[model samples]
Target: MRFATWAGGAGVVSDAGLHPLPSGVSVLDLVCSGLPAALEAGSSALAGPPVPLASVRLLAPLTPPTVRDYVAFEEHVEGVRKSIDGVGGVPPEWYRAPTFYFTNPYAVVGPFDDVPVPPGSERFDFELEVALVVGRDGTSLAPGDVDIFGYTIMNDWSARDLQAREMKVGLGPAKGKDSATTLGPWLVTADELEPYRDADGFLALDLRVSVNDTLVGQDLLSNMGWPFEELVAYASRGTWVRAGDVLGSGTCGNGGCLAELWGRGHDVPPLVPGDVVEMTVEGIGTIRNRVVSGVDLPPVQAARPRPRIRRRDV
Candidate 1:
């Protein structure tokens, strides 16, 4: 079943619809793993007020008490390698279990929201990713320890210029990722999306993105280096994954602004103010965010033009 939290009147995303839960409950709550149970229950509950999907502002399904975005896509790894490392290959360690980094939970915004482009960012780009929302709270979970509550499309909006600047310093992806991250439309429960994963255990959703009607990034879900479960186990090795936490499948191969536009031309146009970005991963949903330029506050007057009385004194 599909589950959604949306803002109809206030900032809160009310429980509109979902699948059946373990018990008979209408409102879905964050549990250990995904919201499968809550979704199940919500789906089975008596119909609530019909809040049209179009009218509500969809937030990240889960508040993600915490967030860990993993760089587990081989395509992205290889692409960056070829461009930066000048080799068309991946590092030996990149094939290991899904590895991740903490993304600022506070920086997350809902669907159809305006993502503020960092000031001076000339190469602002987009990443099409799928994020898992942990429903249960646990520590050191074994494989299959947690069940997925659902999946959502994520736009890991990137600042390529800042990224290049920081990577040269060898610090990390900081500054490369800040200011804004987008997720949602709604949380598609596991049951609804189970058919999309192939027998190889890799997801098989059709993921694609476009900027102002121009197709840029594209990929099949079947290509992820590590599945969600492995990432969960690897991530939870020393840390605990609590309910409402988000785990993302890093950028896809051939995905993102840099990889797609690579060699397109030396005069590649960078994202500027007023650009509209859209991402759609099959089964999840579409996320649309507009880029807005950062501006300075009100200008200060120069002492009222040095006071006209100065002319009278002269």
Candidate 2:
């Protein structure tokens, strides 16, 4: 069963219709309630008649309590690093553990919406990724004990120019990433993927991305160097992971932005206003978005060297 939350309330999508969750309750609320029965009930029928999928304005299924995005594919990391610096080697610690950063959850957007290109950014881009929604609170949860409620398509929108400038300072990708993140046509429950679970314990799915209908790249979920479960365990190592938190598997190889593509001599143009990006993850579904222009609040201008530091004494 697939679940989604819109302006009105949360609901499950079945062959019949989009069945609503109990009044005033949301997918976030249901997850936070931490009741297995509540989650189970999402797939069952409801009292009222269902709504047509086309009628509702779907929001990001849940307003995440927090979002932790991890880089799980070595190929993706290597591709980016090689593009930026002409180098290739997995960081020593990457094989030992997963690494991630917290990003703004407030900027999340639904699948069928327009994403604003952050101002002063000409190198805007999209990252094709898979996201896992945590459903239980567990402190230092063992990998075996980790509970993955569902999966969804994630487009971690980026401002490459800003990201490059900030990384030089060794402190932020914050503003570079805060503008928007697109998630979901709907959430596909874990049980729905049971058939595709591989022996190595990773879900195997074909993920492909396109811009303006031209295929850019594709990667299999099994290509991930670090599986999702291990990342969840690392996330819970010393903290409480609550329901409604989103854990992302970072961009798949060849599934990243023009920054890496251009760096490698690919002729792709950077994303701009009027471009449409569509990503399809087998089973989960496709999420498409149109890029639109946006203006920065305080208005900014390119920095100019202040007359060259008038010089010094004899």
Error of 2 at 242 (Å): 1.0
lDDT of each: 0.69, 0.83
Clash numbers, per candidate: 22, 0
Off by over 4 Å in 2: 43-47, 84-88, 296-314
Error of 2 at 172 (Å): 2.5
Residue-by-residue lDDT tens digits, candidate 2, 205-283? 9999999999997889888877787878899998888887899998888755565576566777889899999999999
Q: How far out, in Å, is residue 155 in model 2?
A: 0.6
**TM-score, structure 2 vs. true:** 0.91
| TM-score of candidate 1 relative to the true fold | 0.82
Model 2 clashes, total count:
0
